[model samples]
Target: MPDRVYLDWNATTPLRPESRAAMTAAFDLVGNPSSVHAEGRQARRVIEEARESIARVLGAAPRNVVFTSGGTEANVLALSPGLRAPAGPVERLLVSAVEHASVLAGGQFDRKELSTIPVTPSGVVDLERLRAMLAGGPPALVSVMAANNETGALQPISQVAEQVRQAGGILHVDAIQAFGKIPFNVSELGVNLATVSAHKIGGPKGVGALMLGAGIEGPAALLRGGGQERGRRAGTENVSGIAGFGAAVKAAMAALDADLARVGSLRDRLEAGLRQTTGVVVFSSDAPRLPNTTLFAAPGMKAETAVIGFDLAGIAVSSGSACSSGKVQPSHVLEAMGASSALAQGAVRLSLGWSTGPEDVDRCLEAWRKLSLSLLKRSGETELERF
Candidate 1:
């Protein structure tokens, strides 16, 4: 375990020291935040401080930030029908073909009313097609991720937002993958709602926030119990997790520029090394992407086999999104990008983090080289047998 090289930060990052410290401090506090006593006020203060901290970094008002169980819940909460501007409910749902499983599942909408906007070969949303889709439909809720979790392809969210606005529709941007990896402002992006997760940015899991734009009334409460989160979500707060989320946001924002430059360089080096092998193809290579992600595959090489090979070599990588990694299926992200079944089945994702170093990249490259050679040799043997 000590020798293991972790290259799957996009799945979930290692917790930051700042977040851990905050969570430890929060654990010592004893109070029900909803109570009227002094202890209750103290607990309430902790949550409010965290709200303010996260809001500051995200360029949102503290009132507009609603904490949820995680990105999935945040996304589900945002998908509610009437949570948009101009007073009418969204009658349908339209999501990108390459969205995370949570978004692709079409939260709150019936299956028949849900539609998929296709992506280009480079994994970007097709804006022209989106325009046509919007024109043909009622005021639909268009959900597009700021970045694809598996391929790291950045979506044309700003452009998409403009189209959605012109069509009198609402836009919900899933920023879970893009939150700490790149700069984004909900207002600037013209998105009515956005979802962000803490664990992906070195904070605790089971904690995320939904950011609502100014004057935007969020959806009705998903969990209506204690009237917490200003009736947006109903539950007792995860005080420690929220504290960690706040600390992680501050730390990630402070280190964003430097971390991006460092991780981007390492990703480039890793891809260059992987490209030395024949038959390797990098997904979304021509599109704008996250600074620390690469999804690549060698034809005839199975992703499950390659993932196991890397694990045996003490390097951690993933075939695709961690949520769906356990399943032996082709990546829907790649499939939406028009990849063949063979290429989709072979796709592997390597994502770096702020803690990644040159040595980590070197270790991954070494492991990949061995795996590629073994697969190539196996393919050669099968061909010879056929002859």
Candidate 2:
């Protein structure tokens, strides 16, 4: 057998060497960042330095970054109500239909009044619908992802943020898929809150950041304990993880353009190769997408079976959102894009990353050909029923 060809970069990336080295160095420092002693000060220095590095890469102020356990906690903390809300009434929570399960399950909003903004077939948000929804009621806090995790569809967050601001509503962007892969300027996006995960960018999995723009205050603490993260998130700082995250962020910023070109080419090759098979339709193919991701469906094939088939062939792939991997439900992202349950059932996602190479892409393509043949033969059908 050969090394596994990982095409699930959209789920998480392998840690970069630079990130690993930084984490190794941080492990030697034995001091609580919250302590006032010399050791504590040293630890604090490490944390702040990491913060500055991350802030520089994201084009945000160092003071605006709040380290969280990961993107889930960050998003939850960002959406929670601060100390100033009036008693009795809950704030409106507007979430896009294609949000990650983390955002959907955070429980930071009211379920009864939960407004879902629709997306176009291209996986872009229907701005006209959003505007109408905004005008239909009092201003509501809007949460939209910068990119669709499954389809790799890029959202018009800057324009959406502008609309939210004009409506006196706050915008929270789940930027887990966008941060290091694409250019992210918090100020330019005009979002009050932004969520980014380290694992998506070749950093440690347990570390993520919630960036808050200047002068904007968010909801109260989801975690109550010793005051950390400037009294926002409460926990002992993840020094090693933060260091790794900072290193990865800096490295990603330096190599983004080149990485984009290389990965984009590989993605194109993968999509084109899959298309040679009959009844293969690539989702979000007509939209602007993350350079390294492709979502496609093999008609008459079961996604679980295809995933297992690819895994057996030494290739790693996903059926839908990684967060919902073990569940049997079809992808909400694809369903939102008007894909019927049957079309959504056969959907597969192949995402590249900084470490992806031509050989990996070729290997994946070869595996797909073998699996599709076996799958179609087993089903005794060449085409899947259209919705």
Candidate 3:
């Protein structure tokens, strides 16, 4: 078998060496963080240091960061709605139509009245529609992702936060895919809560954080346990994972400029290679997007078939969102962009990351050229690549 090309960074990133080393070093310690013994104190020190590192990258105070099981848990905790705080009047949940399934399935509010802000054809949130929804009387909680996982379309989160504030609402931005790849400052976004995952940033999986800004409403406990995460989320902290996460965050920041430059160039080259052939369309091409993701479709090509073909060719890609894999459903993100079911079914996403290089994208394009030719033949279209 040939070496596989991994272009599905939106699903998860490979563990970086720094994160691996941190986790290994943490494993040498033998104390519970909650204990008062010397061993416990050492463990606590590691945790606190990791907390500070993560807080620094997010431009948040260390005290305000709450570590959770992962991004899913972080989002679920962030969406908890209650009038526990003195801020007053908390009643609704507004989620962008393109949020991850975790946010959609978090059960933060009554499912009956959950409001969805529509997106334009370009896969951007319809601000006018959002403003109209905000005009109503219920106190709202708005959840918008920093970027779409499939299309890489960047959301106007700062603008969304302003709207939420004007409407007396709280905003939560899921920055899982945007954190390491893009420039992010919590102060600039002005959101009440932001969720970021470790694995998405080359840290270990199973650890993530929810950044709570000042004045955000307190969420009811998602898990009831022996009082962890400062009573916000209750569970034994994955101390090693958190340490790895901190290391990954620092490494990502240090490499951000070089990564952004490399990924942008490689992504453009791959997209251009695909476009050179006929019957190819890039989703959200005209909109601002992350440098590393591309969602494209060819006429009469089903995504499942394309995915299998690419996989057999030693390339890995995704049809829609990785979180919704094996569900046999069309992409909600593409449907929100007004793509027909056929077009949506034909779309596949290729996302690059820190480990990606020019050669990786080149390999992907080569495999794509072969697969596209075979797919065209099977669909009875003229062989565009044969020329």
Best by lDDT: 1
| Total residue pair clashes for candidate 3 | 0
lDDT of 1 at 272: 88
Q: Backbone clashes per model, in order?
A: 0, 4, 0
Clashing pairs in 3: none
Score candidate 1 by TM-score against the native. 0.96
| Candidate 3 TM-score versus the reference | 0.96
Residue pairs in clash, model 2: 80-219, 81-219, 81-220, 82-219
Better of 2 and 3 by TM-score: 3
How well is each residue in 326-353 modelled by candidate 2, as lDDT tens digits? 5688888988899978878988899998
The CA lDDT of each predicted structure is: 0.87, 0.84, 0.86
Off by over 4 Å in 3: 83-87, 321-327, 383-387
Compared with the true structure, what per-residue lDDT tens digits does model 1 show for residues 26-83? Answer: 9998999999899888888989998998777667899999999999999988887766
Better of 1 and 3 by lDDT: 1
